[model samples]
Structure formats: C-alpha cells, structure tokens
Target: MPLPLYLLAVAVFAMGTSEFMLAGLLPDIASDLDVSVGTAGMLTSAFAIGMIVGAPLVAALARNWPRRSSLLGFTLAFAAAHAVGSSTTSFPLLFATRVVAALANAGFLAVALTAAAALVAPDKKGRALAVLLSGTTVATIAGVPGGSALGALLGWRAAFWAVAALCLPTALGILKGIPAGRAREQTIGGAALRAELAQLAMPRLILVMLLGALVNAATFAGLTFLAPVVTGTAGLSELWVSVALVLFGIGSFVGATIAGRLSDRNPGAVIAVGGPLLLIGWPALAVLADEPVALLLLVFVQGALSFALGSTLITRVLYEAAGASTMAGSYATAALNVGAAVGPLIAAAALNTGAGSLGPVWSSGFLIAIALLIAFPFRAMIRADSNTEVLQ
Candidate 1:
C-alpha cells in the first residue's frame, strides 16, 4: 500500500529476474565457460543453497542494523555481484558470484518482507506481503522473459549487465523512500539473538513453517519440469512451451493478488478451499497431459491454485511468528527456499523411474496430499490469531 512497499517490489523484480533468468542463459554460459549445460545448471542450485543459508545468517547479523541501510547495502552488493559475474571468464569465478548474489538477494528479501509487513497496519499485513511478492510473479511474467530476450539479442553477459544496471535506481529509490531508524531496535543484543533462535522450539511456529515449505515444494515439483509436459507430453511445438509458461505466470499473478486480500480476512477458508483444488488439479493435469488444450488450461488453473494456497501459508507464517522476533521473515524465506531446493530433486527421482513428464505431476500430487493432511488437524490452530489461545 505504501510507496516504500512498491519500491521494495521493484528491488525484488530485479533480484527475482536475476534468480530465474539464468534458465534461459545457461546454454550460453555453459558454452562460453567450456562447461556442460548440466554443470551450468548448478548455478541455479548454488543460488538456492545460498538463499537458504543466507536468509537467517544475514538477517541475524543485520538484526541491529537499520532496515533502510540493510536493504540498500544488499541491493548494491547484488548489483556488484552481477557486474563481476558478467565480466568473469572463469567458471569458478562466475559460480562464486552467483553465490554472493544469492546471499545479497536473500538478505534483501528477508528484510524486505519484514519491512513490508511493518509498513502496513496489522490487518493489512497480508495485502502488503502480497504486493511485495507480486514482484516475483511479475518477474516470472515479464522480467525473466525480458532478460531472456536481452540475452538473445546481445549476449548472456549483457543480461547480467542489464540486471546490474537496473539495481542502481532501485538502490537510489530505497535510500530515498525508506525511512531511517526502522530497524529492529527491540532486538539489538545477545538476548534478542537467543530469543530468535528459541523460536525453533515453538511447535506452532514450526508447524506453520513446515506447511509453508511443503506447499511450496509441491508447487515447484510440477513447475520445474513444465516445459517437458507442455511439449513432450502435450505434443505441442517448442513455441507452445513459452505460451504455457506465460499462462502459468499470469495465473500466479492473479492468484497471489486475490489471495492477499482474502487471506487477511479468512486465511483458513482460503487454504481449505484452495488446497483441495490444488491437490486435484495436479492429478487432473497428469491425466489430461495428452490433451493439448486441457494441458494448457490446467497449467493455468494449477498455477492459480498453487500460489493461492502457497501465499496463504506464507501469510500464516507472518501471523504465527508475530512478536517472536524480526527473524520471522527469515524463517519464511528459508522455508520457501528449502522447498525450492527439495522439490525438483523429488521430481527428478520420479523421472528417473521412467514416469516421463507425468512423474512431476504425480510427485506434486503426492506432496500436496501430505500437505493437506498436515494442515487438516491444524485448521483451527491456523485460523486462530497468534495472541489467542492455541487451539488443541
């Protein structure tokens, strides 16, 4: 809702694009560096690993620092990393830069999530988070594609340079827009660190985090291999893969936007209704993989349901971790990345079993089914406010 929130979203767009655009640039990077495409793919894994480790580490280190300064520092660091990465001829150097960039990106996102929630009223926290996360969805729709096109027109290095250049204005905007002294003044010392760490023992908090991770894992299990599903199974041409991706991205954007408004009022209802639809959509997609038209439509529908449920779970994390520590945002970020790291691995295992494109879809279905079971008994707990008595 606030201008500062939008500015954070802009920063997110730049970082998000850098995170995902590598998918298109991997071939170029691999060929230029004399590495195989599979090796180049590790760059994505490196980023994911960095994000998982960095969110909590960076957030803890900067817990005493002002939010505005932390954001600006991370943004600039990310830009610098990209600049170095683009210029590097050495694969090892490029890989190191990817790790560094991911660290900066994770730090920025962790702080940005907390800052965005702080920028709004308690009741508006969900909407604020939605607005902040919409940047990533929009990145999926526009920024990633734009980066790919830039890579195609110029060179892969050009796309990196472009991301670096975009960050300068984002840094300037953060400095201009975010107010000073907005850091976690309440958690400035050793006691605060202990308090943050102690959150790991809270059953309710852990449950929410687990749910967030599981839902995200399920979403990615299918999402990562969508190209094969669109082309190999659906009998579509290569061009249709891009169309399928765009349709999914559009659905994600819409779902997240709507879920933000709804989750604030009734997160339980949002999850309860969306979860079943998501569970069913995965299997339905797998069953209809041969039907090009159905596959395309289901891709869109599945994206909507996946993000709708995923965003609601993330919003729930905010509330569940309320008043615990500023590290709450770090917890959410880490959970999501954990899922991002694990989902594709599970899907890969399924694929190894000769399941073809359908492996990922079934894998997704299995994961969501488990998520629903975990959340079912906890529905009352999820719906209850953090300050209220814990539902048994």
Candidate 2:
C-alpha cells in the first residue's frame, strides 16, 4: 500500500462514519428537530439514493479526471456538506445538506476504490482493496460508536459537527499523501474497454456484485426488524437492544478485517465460509431470541460473516473485471447502495401485519439460504482463473 492508499482509507473512514452515525443518532435528531423517527430516517435513505445515482454518474463524469484530484475535490465537498448539516436545525435544510453531502461522499468512494486498485500490484489488488475497505470497518468499530456517544452526551448536532471536524485533517492528509498518476489509457478508454466488459468475465463479475448486494439485504431485512421482534417476542429492555446493536457493529468490523486478509489469501474459501455461516446463524438467531444473550451472539456472528462476503466479492470483481475495474467497481458499489436502500423496506413490509417481526426474520433466513445456492457463479469464475495456462 502507498501513502495515497492510507489517505484514501482515512477518507473512507470519515465517509463511513458520516453515513452510518446518523442511524444511531436518529432518535435524538427526530425529537430535537420536531419530526418523527420515520422522517429522520429519510436522512439515511437520502445518502443511499445519492450513492446509487452518483456511483455510476460520478464515476463516468470523473473518469477522465486525475484520481487524486477527484478524491480531494469530492472530499472537500463532503466536508462542506457535513459542516452545513451541523449548523442547521431546519428539517428541510438538513435534508438538502444530506443529499449534497451524500453525492460528494459517493463520488469519493467510486474514485477512491479505483485509485486504490491502481496503486498496488495485480496479485495484490485484493489485499490492497481489503486494506482500503477496512477503513469502513474501523469506522463501524470506532468512529460511528464514538460519534453516537458524543451526540448522546452533547447534542445530535454535535455528531455532525464531529464529522465535519474530521474534514480539515482528512483534507490535509489526502493532499499530502495521495500520489499523482493515472492508469494506462487502454485500460480506461473507448470501445476496447467496452469489449473487455462484454467478455464472460465481466458479466460473472457483475453477478457476484449482485449476489453481494442480495446477501446484505437478506441479513439486514432480518436485523433491521430485530428491535421490534425483541420487544414483542423476546421482551428485552431498551438497554439490551442498544447493546445488541453495538455487538452487531463490532462483529461486522471484525468480520470485514479478517475476511479481507483471508480473501486475499483465498477468495473461494471466504465465500464458501460466509454463506454457510449466515445460513446456520440466522436459525439460531430466530430460535434463541428468548435468550437475549444467546441470540445477540448469533446475530453478531451473522452480521460479521455477511459483510466478510462483501470484502471477498470486492477482490473477485476487480480480478474478473480487468481493464475496466473502475467501471465495474462503480456497479458493485451500486449493488450495495441498492441493498442498503431496499433492506429496511422489505423488513417493514414483512413486519407490518403485527406478526411480532418474526415474519421478516424468517423471510430473511429463507432468502439467504437461497442466495447461498447462487454463489457458485462467482466461485466458478475464480476457479476458472486457476485453469488458465501460463503463456510465457
């Protein structure tokens, strides 16, 4: 990894924190701003929608710009958005700020991943990407939790202020650290690149991206509905519910870090392990909800393993989607953005009948089991690479 990589990872950390910490601070925000919880959640949806739209659009628009400049430029825009978000009490004003911030954040993500891949060797791309994505994990473990605590103690506005504060250091870090350069034009431009994407490799790679998205939806569909399930079925205290959420975040962070390393060593093994872990964990999660301690344990592991699959999928896509890694990376991020957007809605629909949220969890469990059967397409693609002969 290079200095540019380190700086980019910092940007990812700040971006991840700004994106997710809002979830933890929602109760405070809604009450303080005189809006309902459902309305404040629009903040989360706004970011995902922006990310979905920006992933491809920004990736294309900035395709020709220097990566370092794009990252620096987008990051500064992101910082300004957060700064604006912190200063506002008006719901509509904050809403507008969130959209702009999210767009900047999305652009930064698409370009940064492409830049990170370019900084490392071919065989090391997985490892390099793992290292990069780990920034998000670090945010899950440290930044989001810390910001949430800060918000709870001070004010919800303080959380956005905290995130906005990071911008100054992040800007200075990226400016000094990221290297200046570009990939070969052949890898980035024109019909030849489109032809490369048309090969069997690219479709399989995008399929892997979709599978990654679906798995996230499957897990979150259940997890998002868990609080209601716990209240109605498990009869847990609000304190324990918060604890459970923390456990899940911790597990996700740990899972991503370990999975990145493992995938770099062998992506097939990580994918193989991730699906079964989710398949087995969800049943235990549902069956043991009565035992708050036990169910939280299972759910933690499930959350962790689910995203470990994501880290591996990242490596696999870059490898298979060669010559157009940036474009492919944009699509992959779009899948994730779509999943994040849709997961809660699916859970809400399943839980709407006053079925104690059990319906959503069961629905999620069944879907993941089906998704496991579909992962073979990606596994087969990676294995195909093993069969190619050395041309030298």
Candidate 3:
C-alpha cells in the first residue's frame, strides 16, 4: 500500500533477476568460462551460500542504522557486484562476484521486509509483505525470461550488465522516494535475544526449518538445470526455453498470490495441497519429459507449487518463532537459501554422473515427497503459535 513497499519490490526485482537468471545463462556460461555445465551450476550454489550467511550478518551490522540508509547501502553494493560480474572473464572471479552480489541481495531482502512492515498498519502487515515479495514473482515474469532472451541475443555478460543498470534506479528510488525512518525499538537484546534464538533449537522449529530447506532444495534442483532439462527432454529450441520460463514465472505469480491470500485463514490447507501438488508436478515432469505440451504445463504447476510451499512454510516458521519473529524471518530466509545452495549442488552432482537431464527432476520430486511426510508429524506444533511467548 505504501510507496516504500513498491520501492522494496523494485529492489527485490533486481536481486531476483540476478539470483535466478543464472539458470538460463548456465549453458552459455559453461561454454564461455571453459567449464563443464555441472561446474558452472556452482554459481547458483555460491549465491545461495552468500544469502545463507549474509541475511543475519548484514542485519546485525545495520541493526542501528536508519532503514532507508541500510536499504540504499545494500542495493548499491548489489548493483556494484553485478557490474564486477559483468566484467569478469574468469570462472573463479565470476563465482566470487556472485557471492558478493548475493550478500547484498540478502541484506536488502532482510531490511526491505522490515522496512515494509514498518510502513504498514498492524492489520495490513501481511499484505505489505506480499507486496514487497511480489517483486521476486514479478522478476520471474519479466526479469528471468528477459535476461534469458538478452543472453541468447547478446551474451550472458550482457544480462549481468542489465541487472547492474537496473539496480541504480532502485537505489535512487530508496534514497529519494522512501523516507529515512527511525529504527524500530530493540525490546529484546543480550540475554533476551539469546533466549529467543535458543528456541530455534526446539524440535518443532527445527522441523519447520528443515521442511523449508527441503522444499527449496527440491524446487531449485530442477530449476537450476531447467535450460538443459527442457531442451533435452522436449527438444525445445533456445527461443522456446524462454517461452517456458515465462510460463513458469506466471505459475509462480499465481501460486504466490494464492498462497498469500490463504496464508492467514488456512495455512494448513495451503501446505497439504501445495506439498502434494509439488511432489506430483516434479515426477510428472520427469516421467513425461518427452511430451512438449506436458513439459510446458508441468513447469507451470511446479512453479506454482514451489512458491505455495514457500509462502506457507515461511508463515509456519514465523508462527513457531513467535518469540523471535524478526530473527525468525531472517533465519527462515537463511534456511531457504541453504536449500537453494544444497539443491543445485546435488543436482549438479547428478548431472555429472551421466544421469542426464531427467535425473535432477526425479530426485527433486523425491525430496518434496519427504518434506510432505515430515510436515504431518509437526502439524500440531506448527499450529500452536498463539500459545508461544512473544519476543521480550
């Protein structure tokens, strides 16, 4: 609802594009960098590792800074990292740049969400967060496909350059448009913060984080290799792969929107439905690899289910970590990134085994199925949020 939320969305769009565009660019990167495709996939893992570590680390460093300053600082660093990535010709240099970019991305995401929440009324907090997060979904719709097309027409480096250029405007928007709001009060600190964080070790909280990680890992395993999978399985032309990406983005948008709407009233239902749907979608895509129409449709379904699970999973984590809500979101963010990093690593390993393109897809489906089973035993614990202690 606030202009700040929209600005946050823009920041997220730039980050999301940089985060995901690599999937589409992997084929090009591998060839140009003189590495195998499997090796090039480490780019995604490197980015994820950055996020996994950066969210809390950056949040801590900027904990006392003005919200707008933190957001702008992180965004500028993000843009600069992309610029460095665009110029680098070496694989190790490129990998290092991705890690730098991801750290900026993670800091921006953590602060942007906090800033967005600060801008809204208590009743509208969820809606505000949805608006901020929609940037990533919108990135899938526009940035990812657009980056792929640009990479196809120009070069993969061009995609990074474009992302770098896009970030400047977002940084400017944060500076000139969003107000420099005072920091929210730190009601809990020292021993209190330690106690809150310690609750993260509870079985229920651990299970939820594990579930989130597994879902992300499953989704990204196939996603990181989507270019090869579709091209190999459905015999798609380069142009058609972009088209499929658009479809996948559309599904992600729809799924995230639907999940956001249902999150408050029926989080359980969202999980029950989305989890199984993802499990079904992943394997169906693998088994029906030869069917072009099915390939297209399944990608959409997989995208939807993946985000649906993501939305619901975050909600569950917040509930479980009611005593440390802010840190909970950051921790959940890290967990998701952990999955993002590990999933691709596993998929790359499979690809190197000569398991072919379908191997990652099927393997991801199995992981999703395991996540669903894990969810059931923890259902009551996840639902017990109202009884939990508040932070401070």
Candidate 4:
C-alpha cells in the first residue's frame, strides 16, 4: 500500500522478467550459438550459480550501505547486465552476462526484501512481501510468455533488449517514488545483522528455510525442463507447448496472489497444499491427464502450487526474528538461491541422462518430500514460536 512497495515492484518486475525469460530463449540461444540445448541450458545454470554466490556476498558487502543506495546501485548493475546479455554474440560472453545478471538478481532481491520489510508495519510485513513477490508472479505471466514471443519474432536478443529497456524506466520510478534517504541500508544494521544471526539462530526456522529451499529446488529443476516436458513427453507441438507455458505462467501468477493473501491467514496450509499438488502434478505429467485441456489444467495447478508459499516462508523467517529481521531475511534468501543453484543442476543432469522426461518430476517429488520430512519435527516448534512472536 506504500509508494516504496510499488517502486520495489517495478524493479522486481524487471528482475523477474529477466530470470524467467531465459527459459523461452534457450532454443534460439542454442541455434544461434550452434550449441546443444543442454549446453545452452548453462544460461539458467549460470544465473542460479550467480545468485547462490552473489546473495550473501552482496548482503555482506552492502551491509554498510544504505538500503536506497544499495538498491540504486543494484539497479544500475542489473540494467547493465541486461544490456550486455542482450547484445552478446558468443556463448561464453553471453554466459558471463548471465552471471552478471544473476549477481545483480540476488543483490536486488536481498536488498529489496529488506527494504520492503522495513517500509511496512510489523504486522503486515507478510503483505509487503506479497506485493514484492507479486511482481515476480506477474513476471511468470507477463515476462516468460512475452519473452517467448519476442524471441520468436525478433530473436532471443530482442527479449533481453526489451528487458533492458524496462530497466531505465523502472530505475527512474524507484528514484522518483522512493524516499531517497529512507530507502537506504544502515552500517549498524549490518553489524547488528551478524550479531542477530549469532544470537537468534532458531533451529526450527533454519529447518524451514532449508526445507523451503529444497522443495523449491525440485520445482526449479522441473521448471527449467518444462518445454521439453510439454513437447517431448506430452507429444505437443512446439507452438502449442509455448502456449501451454503461457497458461502455466497465468496459473503461477494467480497462485502467487492467492499465496500472498494466504500468508496472513494460513502460510502453513499454503505450503502444505503446494506439496501435494506438485506430487500429483509431477506424476500427472507422466500421464495424469488425457485431454489437452486436462493437461493444461494439471500444469497450471502444478506451477501455481509449486511456488505458492514463497513469500509466506520469507515472512515466517522475518516473523521469527523480530529484532534481527534483516539477518533472518538474508539467510532465507541465501538458502533459496542456493537451492535454485543446486536444484536445476541436479535436474538437468537427470533429464540429460536416460532417466526419462519425468526426471524433474521425480526430483521435485522427492525434494518436496525431503523438505517436508526435514520440516516435520520442527512444525510444532515453529507453531509454538510463531505463537511466541519471535523465531530465535
């Protein structure tokens, strides 16, 4: 509801768009570079790796900087990344640009979330997160499919270029709308962040972050391979497959909106529901649906549920650490990015091997199961702590 939230959303929109658009660009990227699809897939891998590497480092480096300056600097870096990524000809150069984007991506999220949390009241912190995440959700619908069309008509470079164009205006909006001084991070906050982590490291909340990362890892692993899953396994045409992805994006966007609201009411339920739907959706792709409509429905539900509780989980971490909120938030962000890196690498390997097209589904089902298992013993602890109004 605040102006800063909307400013963050614009930045998030560009970030989310760049992140998801690469999937749709893979074929074009592969063809242009004369590489295998598996090889071209490195773009996704590179980005995740960048995120995993950049998140904590960026947080630590920007620890002394004001949040506004951190984000402003982050935006400039992100805009450059898109420009480089869009214009590069060689694969290695493009890969480097992706890494740049990834670094900027992680930094943007880490900084933005901290800022978003700072902007809102303590009670409605979850909704503030939801507003930021809404940009990402909307990206699934607006960015991924739009990028696909951009690649189709003008080449994948065009998609990146469009993303680059989005950056300028977004940066301007952030500058204009956000309170210049208020948007910055603090030096004491950084030292405080470290101290908070040391003092308030709640085991149960840690478990949730770890588990959340793992569950989402499976989703990423499968998500990265969705085009093949649709076209190869489902026996759909490429064009139709793109259309299906568009629908999936639509579903994910809606799911994210619902999850945002649900975080206030029932984050636990939102997460719990995502797991089962994903379990069903995973096997369903192997033959869960017979009709085209049925197939689309299944995939849509899968995407929606898979990422359903992303903001809720973040909110929980922040909720648990009332005093050391930034540290808790940073750790959770780092964990998720680590999962993003690890999940797809493992999944790509699975799909590349003879494990079948359903490799990601199995990975996701197993990861979600693992995450759930890890979180089981801590559920009561978490509930107790949430009731306590502090995590650590």
Candidate 5:
C-alpha cells in the first residue's frame, strides 16, 4: 500500500534473484573455478547455512541501530559481495562471497519483515508481507530465468554482475524510502536480548515456527528436484522444464496474493483449506509423475497450495512472536531458511535410496503430513484469535 513497501519488495527482488540464479550457473562456475559441479553446488549449501545462522545474529547485533541505516548497510554489502564474486576465479573466494551475500540477504529480510509490518496498519500486515514476498515469486518467474539466459549468452560472471548492478538502484530506493528509527520504541540491551531469546522457548511460538519450517521444507523438497521430475520421469524435453517451473511460479504468485488477503481475516481458514489440499496433491504428484499432462497440472496445484499454506504459517509466526523485543522477524527468517535447508537434504536422501524422480514428491507428502498433525492443536487457538479480531 505504501511506496516504501514497494521499494523494500524491489530490494528483495534483487536479493532473491541472487539466491536462485546460481542454480543455473553452477556448471559454468565449476568449470571456471576448476572444481566439480557437485563442489560448486556447495555454494548453495553455504548460503543456506549463512541465512540460518545470520538472521537472528545479525538482527540482535543491529537491534539498536537505526533501521534505515541497517537496511542500507546490508543492501550495499550484498551488492559488494556479488561484485567480488563476479571478479573471483578462485572457488574458495567465490564460496566465501556467497556466504557473505547470504548473510547480507538474511539481515535485509529480517529487518524488512519488521519494517514492512511497521509501515502498515495492524489489520494490513498480511497484505504488506505478501507484497514483500511477491518479490521472491516474481524473481522465480522473471529474474532467475533472465539471469540464466544472460549466463547462457555471456558467462556465469555476467549474471553475478547483473545482480550487483541491480542492487545499486535497490540500495538507493532503500535509502530514500525507509525512515530512520529503531524497529521498536524500546531499544534492546543485554537483558532484553536474553529475554527475546527466551521467547524462542515459548511453546506457542515454537509450534508456529515449526509449522512454518515444515511447510517450507515440503515446498523446497519438491521444487529443488522438479527439473529431474519433469525430464526423467515425465519424458519431457529440456525446454518443458522451464515451462513447468513458470507454471509453478505463476501458481505461487496467485496463491500468495490470495493468502495475503485472507490471512488477516482468517489465517486458520487458509491453513485449514490448503493443508488438506497439499496432503492430497503431493501423493497425486508422485503417482502422476509419469503422466506429462497430470504432472504439469499437479505441479501448479501443489505450488499454489504449498505457498498458500506456507505464507499463512509465516504470518502466524509473526503473530506469535510479535511481543519479542526485536527477534520476531529473525525468528521467522530462521525458521524459513531451516526448512529451505532441510527439505532438499531429505529429498536428496530419498533420491539416493533409489526412489527416482518421485522421491521428492513422496518426501514432500511425508513432511506435509507431519505439518498437518502438528497444526491440529493450533486450530482452536487460531479460531479464538479470529473470533477476537472479529469482535474487535
């Protein structure tokens, strides 16, 4: 709703592109750096590890800083990381840059989540968050594909340079848009930090964060291996892999749009409806992996359901953590990246066990089932919250 929110989303777009575009450039990077593709793939693992560790750490360290300055610092740091990465021929240097970039990206996201919520009315927080997350969905649709094409036309370094260049305008936008203030009225100190960390042990907050992580794990499990599923299982051409990804991205965008509107009114309903659909969808995807038409259709449906449910869970984490001094956004960010890391690990294990391309689908189903079971007790709480909102 606000211009600043859009600017934050634009910054997220640049960061999100860097996060995913590397998937397409891994082969080139490996070749240039005199490493195997598998080794280059560790760059992704390094980024994930950075995000998981950096979110809360960075948020706590920057808790007392002016929000605008912290945001600008992270954004510029991200751009610089990419610039160094683009110039590097050493694998270790490039790997270190990815970690640096991921830390900057994590800090930016953690701060931006709180900042976006701060910029909006209480009732509009869901929509504001959705606007911010739309940047990632759009990156999946346009930025990753464009970066891949650039890498194909020029070189892998070109994609990194492009991401760095894009961040320039994003940094400028952040400088212009975000207001100078701490995330909260009360600044965090030693005791405050300990208290905020203590909040992580709260049962309600832990449940919500776990739900968010499980939902995200299920999502990435299927998505990380979707290309192989499309080609190896469905017998499609390489071009069709891109088409399937686009379809999934489109579905995610649409699902997130709907979730944003509905989450504020009734987050329970979003989860209630989406959770069962995903439970059914994942198994169906596994069974239909060999059917081109069915696989394509299910991919879209699964994406929509998974993201709709995932977004709602994230909103719930924000709600549950709202009382934390400064760790609310960091908690959500950490939960998200934890899922991002764990999901693919599980899927990869399944594949290694001779499960073939359908391994991820089955793995997703297993994860979603656990998520649904975990969410069962939360229904009463969610409904009570919804009722209170309606009464207010």
Candidate 6:
C-alpha cells in the first residue's frame, strides 16, 4: 500500500471519530447546552443526513475538480467545522457545525476510496480498499474510545477541539503524500454522463446498493444496543461491556484485513461467505446473549462479518461502475450511512414496542436474511463477471 493510502486512512480516522464520538457525549452536550438529551441527539441525525445527502451530491458536483484538490478542500472544511463546533455553546450552532462537518466527511470519504482504488491495479482494489477501511476500524478501536475518554476528562467541547487538531496533521499528510493531478474524474459529455447514470440503475448495481444498506441495518441494529444487551442479559458489569466492544472492534479490524485480501480474488465469495456467517452469528447471539463467553465470541465474529460485507459491497460497486467510480463510491457511502441511521431506529422501535432485549437480535437476523436474499442475484452477477474476466 502507498503512503497516500495510509494518509487517507488518517483522514478517515478523524472523520470516524467525529461520527461516533457524540454517542458518548450526548448527555454532557444536553446538559451544557440546556437542552433535553433527545434534542441533543438530533446532532447525530443531522450528521447522518448530511453524509447521506452530501456524499453523492458533492461527488457529482466536484466530478470535474482535481481529485487532490477536492480531497484537501474537504479535509480542511471538516477541520474548520470541528473548530467551529468546539467554540459553539448553542445547540443549534453545534448541530449546524456537525452537519457541515459531515458533509465534508462524506465528500472526503467518497473521494478517498476512489483515490485509493486509482492507485492500485484493478485486481487489488479490494485489498486497497481494505487498507483504507482499516482506518475506520481502527477509529472504532482507538478514535471513538479516545474521544470518549477525552470528553470525560477535558469536556465534550475538548473532544471536538481534539478532532480539529488531529485533522491538521492529516491534512498535511494528504498534501505531502498524495500526488497532485492524480485520480481526476474522467471528462465526459452529457450523453456519456447520462449513460454512466444509466449503468448505475442496472439491477445488479441496485442490488449491490441495497445489500450495502441492509448489511449495515442488520449489524448496527444489534450493535447500537450492544452495551445494554451484554450487561442486561449476560449480567456482566459495565466494564465487561467495554470489553465486549473492544473484542468486536478487534474482530472488525481483523476481518477487514482478511476480507480485503480475499476480495482481490473473489469479492463475491467474500460476501457469499460473509452473509451466511452473519445470519448464523446474530441468531446465535440471541440465544447466547446471557452467556459471557458465547456473547464475546459471537460479537467478534459478527463484527468481522459486518465489515466483510461492507468491503465486499464497495468492491462490487467499483467493479460495476468502472467509469463513474466516484459516483459509485459516494452512493455506497451514502447507502451504508442510510442503513446506519435506520438500523438503530428499528432496534429502538422494537425495544420500545415491548420487544425485550432479544428483539434487536432477532430483528438483525431478519434484516440479514433480507439482505442475503437481495444478494442472491448479486452473487450470480459477480460470478458471471468473474468467469468473463477469467476468459478474457
């Protein structure tokens, strides 16, 4: 992997921290801003909305810009937004900053994936993406936890300031490591652009996007309540809950690494293998939610499979959208965030509607099953593409 790839990962680490760190500071933010917890929670919704809407829109509008310039521009924008967030005491101002920051995050991530792919051979896109995604997994492990701890010690505003500070070096790294004039979007006429959009509407492409959304829905529906499930059902202390999260994060990192390497040869198989693994894992988790050992192991495997599904889906989009790589990447990013936003809501609704702790577990299983069904035709498409590649 090139240094630029790792630098892209650094950028993702900062962005991912911003995305998730708010989960731990919602109460503090509510108290500080003199709003209800529920009101403060809307900051998260704002960020997700920005990512979902901003990614594809920015990618399309900036399709004609120099890739490196877009990358730098988005990175700085993110940092600046965080800087504003760090200074703001008003809830509305903070919410607005988060939305702008997420817009920058969405744009940067979409371009980073395409830029990473552009640096590698066609065959290595999976691994290259895996390398890039490792940053996100690492963020789950380090960045979120670190932010939470920092928030606990200094204050929630300090966490935002910290994220802003981190971005400076990341921006500098991207400037130094990434070559100028690389990964520029291909120029095309209106007719050609329309044809690329047409390709994006294909059943196979649509299936890939749906699969991406479903996979995130399945995984996050369960994950959003991991702490409660572990502590409530397993009768573990709050500390053990943290242990479970770390285990899951470790599994995700390992899984992403392995998935990247395997995706190079057969991203379809990665998904095929991953989907069933998820189906089995979630149900087992429900059954074993009370068993500490079983819960730990299942959470790890579930996390791994979740990330595998994510990497494979991105690879599929790249393969299908050869000419419109950034658009495809942005769509994939937005689709997963859409799922992320939806999954927790589904789980929350289930719990609120008299479904016990086990509700999310079963809900995840059902969602994964739906995703696999959608993936069936997608798998065949990938296999056909593989066979054609072999022949060529």
Q: lDDT for each of the candidates?
A: 0.79, 0.70, 0.82, 0.71, 0.80, 0.75
lDDT of 2 by residue, 314-354 (tens): 55655555555446666666777676666656655665455
Judged by lDDT, which candidate is best?
3
Lowest-sum lDDT 10-residue window in model 2 = 383-392
Clash statistics: count for each candidate: 0, 0, 0, 8, 0, 0
Give the residue spans of candidate 6 off by over 4 A: 1-5, 22-45, 66-69, 86-94, 110-133, 152-156, 174-186, 230-241, 264-272, 356-359, 376-379, 382-384, 387-392
Better of 3 and 6 by TM-score: 3
The TM-score between candidate 3 and the true structure equals 0.92
Q: Candidate 4: TM-score?
A: 0.85
Which digits, one per residue and each the tens of the lDDT, describe model 6 over residues 1-392? 77778778888888888886665566568779998644565676678779899987877666566777889999999999999988988888988998899899988876776678787788888788877866777877778767766776777899899888887877787778765654455665677657656776777777777788888877767776665676678998645655666677778788877887887567777877888888998999999998999999998899888888777776666666665634666767777878777776676566655557677778888899998886686467663255322101
* Per-model C-alpha RMSD: 4.0, 4.3, 2.4, 3.4, 3.7, 4.1
Q: Give candidate 2 regions above 4 Å deviation.
A: 1-5, 33-39, 66-68, 89-96, 114-131, 179-188, 196-203, 222-242, 257-273, 356-363, 373-384, 387-392
In model 3, state the lDDT of residue 71: 84
Per residue, candidate 4 scores C-alpha lDDT tens digits across 283-363 of 766565335677777778777776675556765656655666445556666667667777777776677666566676667
Runs of candidate 5 exceeding 4 Å displacement: 1-5, 22-42, 87-93, 113-133, 149-156, 174-186, 377-392
Candidate 2: what lDDT?
0.70
Q: 2 or 3: which has the higher TM-score?
A: 3
Q: What local lDDT score does residue 296 receive in model 5, on the 0 to 100 scale? A: 89
Residues 264-285, model 5: lDDT tens digits: 6788888889999999999999
Estimated TM-score for each candidate: 0.82, 0.79, 0.92, 0.85, 0.83, 0.81
TM-score of 2: 0.79
Which residue pairs collide, candidate 5? none
Off by over 4 Å in 4: 1-7, 66-69, 113-130, 175-179, 182-186, 189-191, 199-201, 261-273, 288-291, 309-311, 382-392
> What value of lDDT does candidate 3 attain over all alpha carbons?
0.82
